[model samples]
Target chain A: MKELSLNILDITENSVKAGAALTQILIDEDASTLLLTIADNGSGMTKEVLQGVTDPFYTTRTTRSVGMGLPLLKLAAEQTDGWMKVESIHISDDPENHGTKVEALFHKDHIDFTPLGDVVSTLLTLIQGHPDTDFLFRHSIRGGEKEVEVHMDTRELREALDDVPLNEYEVIKWIEEYLNEQYNGPEDAEE
Target chain B: MKSLAELQKIKANMKQRIVLREGSGDIRVVVGMATCGIAAGARPVLNELVKDVSEEGLSEKVTVSQTGCIGICQYEPVVEVFEAGKEKVTYVKMTAEKAKEIVEKHLKGGQVVEEYTIGAYQS
Candidate 1:
């Protein structure tokens, strides 16, 4: 992917395809490292699938002969002296307990690492696209002693909406503004 | 940040239209958004479809959605349109500009832009 947000978007789509009812994304950027974690309460992959997930040649979809999401992320991470891991636990009776987690770590200063582009747009797309699914996004940046964090929970937003859809144009515009203000600070708010 | 009061007004206006569009055999515009598609520049095409459809006030009659890979990696950035009681039309190697044309010629004008179709490219 050209941007880290695009990679996040692609991986989250995989979570949705895996039948996730709730997905949590955590991004932490420090002076030296950037970490991304995507966890989902979905149908966890089998050991066989998990083993071959990083192989671009392996895919579960009949419409496509290759799956590039995991592999591409792995390549991107590795290019920056980073690594990735995928863990899954399959549960037949309780889907809430069955899920998968994909995590990748990259060196923040690495030249090969792509920038996080328009993350607000990425999260909003996922939320609007899957209205029934709940999403929790946590982003944090740490430099020296200063740390800034932003958290967005769709479940809480839904309750506040009182039946109004999150994808409503007005609501989406609000969400975009909310994310920007939170991520970039109020001083840099977009007019 | 805008308040919930504004959203309430939008909900009141959109509820009926949204209900009518759901599960109905409306014109469905599906954009392929797999890794290959995105790498080949599908995001802009998808965004254009959403923007144009809404701008043309065809949101109630048309649904612009996304899908995973369609198995045609060579034909990246593929878009498929499915209308009620009609054959599916697949557009290949789509760009934002072509998406606008499709939105106008096919979606709004009710005539397929056959030149952009995969069949046209092949034959």
Candidate 2:
């Protein structure tokens, strides 16, 4: 993926395929570092599967023999002098709490760091593709003494929307504007 | 400063417009979004479909979604369209421009863009 947001979208698709009721995409960025954590309450992988996940040849899908999602993400992180880690608890091992968490740290100062581009569009695509699943997205940037955050939880929207689908054209448009507004902050009317 | 409170307003408005419409459409547009597809630029194609469908006011008559790998890695970024009484049309090696044309011609105009289909690409 050219952009980190595309990587985020590709990885989250796996979570949705695993039947995750909730997926969380969290990003914490400073001047020099960017940390991405994607957690999902889906059917987790076995120890063997987890161990082989970073390998480009490992995949659970019958259609394709190779899975590039995790491997590409690990490559993207390592190229920036950073690392990627994945942890999972299989459904058979712990039925009550089973899921996967992928965390990657990227040094933004490195020359090979991939930019996080058009994340708002990525989030909208996820929601539109899987209306039944819920997503919690939080992105925070720390600069000096100030911290700016953009947060959204689909669960809360579901409660407020009642029967209206989260992927409804109007609702998705509202969400896009909502996220954009947060990023832009309070616009100056006078200027 | 946009808040969840605005969702209530949308809910009220949507309910009146779509009182009993559960599943929106009879036509399904499925985009392959696997690693191969993403690497080959499926995201833009998917976005183009959604944007055009909504803008054309075909939201209620069509549904655009995504699927995993279909074992055709060579033909990444594939799109399949399914209608009520017609055969599924698979479009391969799709770009954003091609997707827009498909929406306007096949979807809105009710005629398949045969040159973009898998049959043309394969044969």
Candidate 3:
């Protein structure tokens, strides 16, 4: 339902929320399918955790955990005749070896994936575009294999890492709100 | 292909704005928008500047623009404010709420929020 960008942005926000150090987003736009993939280096959740994530009422955080991301992501992918799968390894060679990868698929002819603003807005969330974080985005469209790559670093937005101030938060939120306005195609776009 | 003259005409129209001028009576806020800025959440910050300025009726007094990159990607969502007769104030890690505060304090009151300014790090 709606454009796949909304799902893409939604899932990506989850990645940012998962305390990911680096998030990589890959979008494949073709005649057959408009595919979006988001990968992050956050703590890997177990099968039970993953299952719990899909349950709207279950939450991992004691604070606020509506557990809507994975479910919504699953729904969006299924609606587009695509599927979302999560693979996690608890026992890895590295301590920080946790990771999560979510993929959303879409039938190109049946859906409009040309509106890229949603994808942009999703990736520019509050936690995103931070100095400590780095993102690699690749978009392919037009079947010419025509493509574009956008690498956004947090440093470009701000430099003071010692302590985050109120002004900094305002500027970032303002930008987030701005992107939400520019990319209006998706209502459930983590707006 | 489009005609070169048409491009020239478009340029002429854009020139009416005179974006990069030596002396103008407008408050210019530049947000770095390279890959880093976007990752640093600069797009929303820039967008809010436009919305807030317009809503607050500061259209003629302030203008929001985007830059490719500011090199420093850490303090993203960065916003640099420049008035006609004042120093350049760089507000780092900006958000929608903070943008409003800046509008109220610095933009309106002619007072810079020193806490938000990247004082020693001015490059």
Could you list the CA RMSD of all candidates, in the order they appear?
A: 2.9, 2.0, 14.1
- The regions of model 1 sitting more than 4 angstroms off are A62-65, A93-96, A144-148, A185-191, B2-9, B16-25
Score candidate 2 by TM-score against the native: 0.94
Candidate 2 error regions (>4 Å): A144-147, A186-191, B20-24
Best lDDT goes to which candidate?
A: 2
Per-residue CA lDDT of model 2 for A1-191, tens digit only, reads: 88999999999999998889999999999989999999999999999999999999998877657778999999999999999999999999999999999999999989999999999999998998999899999999998466779999999999999989998888998899888878887565443
Model 2 chain A: lowest-lDDT 10 consecutive positions: A182-191
Give the better candidate number (2 or 3) by TM-score: 2
Candidates, DockQ: 0.37, 0.64, 0.04
Q: What tens digits encode model 1's per-residue C-alpha lDDT throughout A1-191?
A: 78888898889988998888889999998999999999999999888888999999998877646778999999989999999999998766454588999999999788898888778878877775777888999999988476879888888778777677777655666677778878666753363
* CAPRI class assigned to model 1: acceptable
TM-score (C-alpha, index-matched) for candidate 1: 0.88
Whole-model lDDT values for every prediction: 0.84, 0.92, 0.59
Candidate 3: residue A48 lDDT (0-100): 77
lDDT of 1 by residue, B13-103 (tens): 7677677767654798998887888778887787677778878878778877788778787898999999989999999999999999999
